[model samples]
Target: MSQSTAAGDAVQAMMRAVVVTRPGGLGALEIKEVPVPVRERGWVRIRVKAFGVNESEVTTRKGESDPEVTYPRVPGIEGVGVVDEADEDSGLRPGQQVATMMGGMGRTYDGAYAQYVSVPAAQVIPFETGLPWDVVGALPEMFQTAYGSLTTGLDLRAGQTLLIRGGTSTVGLSAATLAKDLGATVLSTTRSPDRTGELRDAGVDHPLTDNGTVADQVRELMPDGVDAALELVGCSVLADTLRTVRRHGTVCFTGALAGQWSINDFTPFMIPVGVRLTSYAGEAADLPADVFARQLEAVAEGRLRVPVAKVHHGLEQVQDAQDDVESGTAPGKHVVVLDD
Candidate 1:
């Protein structure tokens, strides 16, 4: 049978959807019944089991995403679930477990905050694992971003000293765990001194509080500066973070939680000779399937960790989830689970 014909053989008509009607706070989100997405020739429909509540989604809800983000759209860039519909030739089939993330999802296109989501077939990552929905749901986007940034962006080595400037964030903790596994000495940071223990338990060898002189504190510890630094706080502190790296150290900017976007006054001379500065904004296709599968294997084998700071029951609780993520008090990421 043809691909489209095969997809037409099994599908549902309508499903529940959570929509952001406008750029507002939590009140703007609407949850109601909506038409089920039709599977295009090379697209796959996922029966979303659970999705992570990302800070990006929170920013989008507050009317602060990229200028091109459209209203009345779903605001989830990551999710995990079963394939409900797929063209036969799409290399996917009903009953398969998969994940979808990045690539205009929850930004310019309908996202995973719904009962169903249709995405390009190539973006549907297939995997086999016995992990529960909630645990696996939190992996796709955050872990892939962490893995890619560590391996591809920084080219991290086994014996280097690495610093995560925003270590308490979900992705930051993931990097700490992975870096520890790679035999790197990991130093992490949080704005609050109380959370230093939390970072230690998460495998951070050192946890420094950010008090405007964080670079000085790091220098006190390393003396020669770190081998690499992952900048998550953004341009406001980019220059300071750059100074905390060694002569030939690598610095990769992966996030902007500090409200500074552009480095308008930047100059190449600002960087020390032999230092390298790079940034990573992982796209949907940026997380490779092979790398993701290896991580999943590690998770299943009890070597890797997925630390969910909080869990909300269903779509109705997504507002609470986002509220917590915005509060920035959670030691880990918040997740919204759909009861199976």
Candidate 2:
């Protein structure tokens, strides 16, 4: 249930959150009552309505502790909620709906897995009309990453050929939809033939399997070779992706699902043919705000569909949601819906 900031002064505040005491699996996450967040200057307390889960969050949670996280942390990267409190000095007001991507939440900072969270005013953004719970919830991590890859990491342009390796993933589909909207030809890959129709509906011109022949398939589609590649499949095919690019073409490798790859040498026999290889780490500020707004508009207009792979109720269900996301049962995105 939504709460009002006006009541902040009168009551003892406590909220529920999903916390991971130690990173292992879903069993490590537990629901507990925590203090309601209070806004600091230039920050606002968000009454988190929904939070989107991603694979990166899962990996970080289970991996060895690094400098970014200590034990007993909340794990949520992106969130959508109403503004509970705002700095009067700033233009923000209470009750404005907003969203934020994974700058620090759920990693180095407290995140939206709780009923309430405090984030910088600049990080919080107001939403226009028609922003749905599912869509807004889904935007933070995947959309921002896609925005980063296409705009910042790779200077994707109209009429270029893009090979998206993970066609059905949240980030992968976002890239495909974004490229198609920008007037580019998007060729994606899926592990299942059953996903072909869905990929087509999502605007992918061609879909292939990860059978080590994606390069051959891509060559058949474009004799000139792909202009760029969004490599979600990982480093195992780095050479293959490079081969698919035209002479002097670019390859933006984002994620590594294929396994560990160490590039000891950048110059190989391919140098004679001319291919550019670069590693991409999501979006930077290079992606314009108007571009992100356009994607949001598409979601609002039904052009972008944020399918709920699975919905788990209550903070206790956070682990189940994580499991579902990892298991890949849900089609698009996995969301955790807190009970009012």
How many residue pairs clash in all the candidates, one count each? 0, 3
Question: How displaced is residue 161 in candidate 2, in Å?
Answer: 1.3
| Candidate 1 per-residue lDDT over residues 112-183, each given as its tens digit | 899889899878889888888888888888887787788778999999999998888888989988898889
How much RMSD separates candidate 2 from the native structure?
3.6
Best by TM-score: 1
- Would you list the C-alpha lDDT of every candidate in the order shown? 0.86, 0.76
Off by over 4 Å in 2: 1-12, 64-67, 259-273, 282-289
List where candidate 1 sits over 4 angstroms from the true fold. Answer: 1-12
| Predicted candidate 2 versus true structure: per-residue lDDT over 62-97, tens digit per residue | 864346776678778778888888888767678887
Q: TM-score, each model?
A: 0.93, 0.88
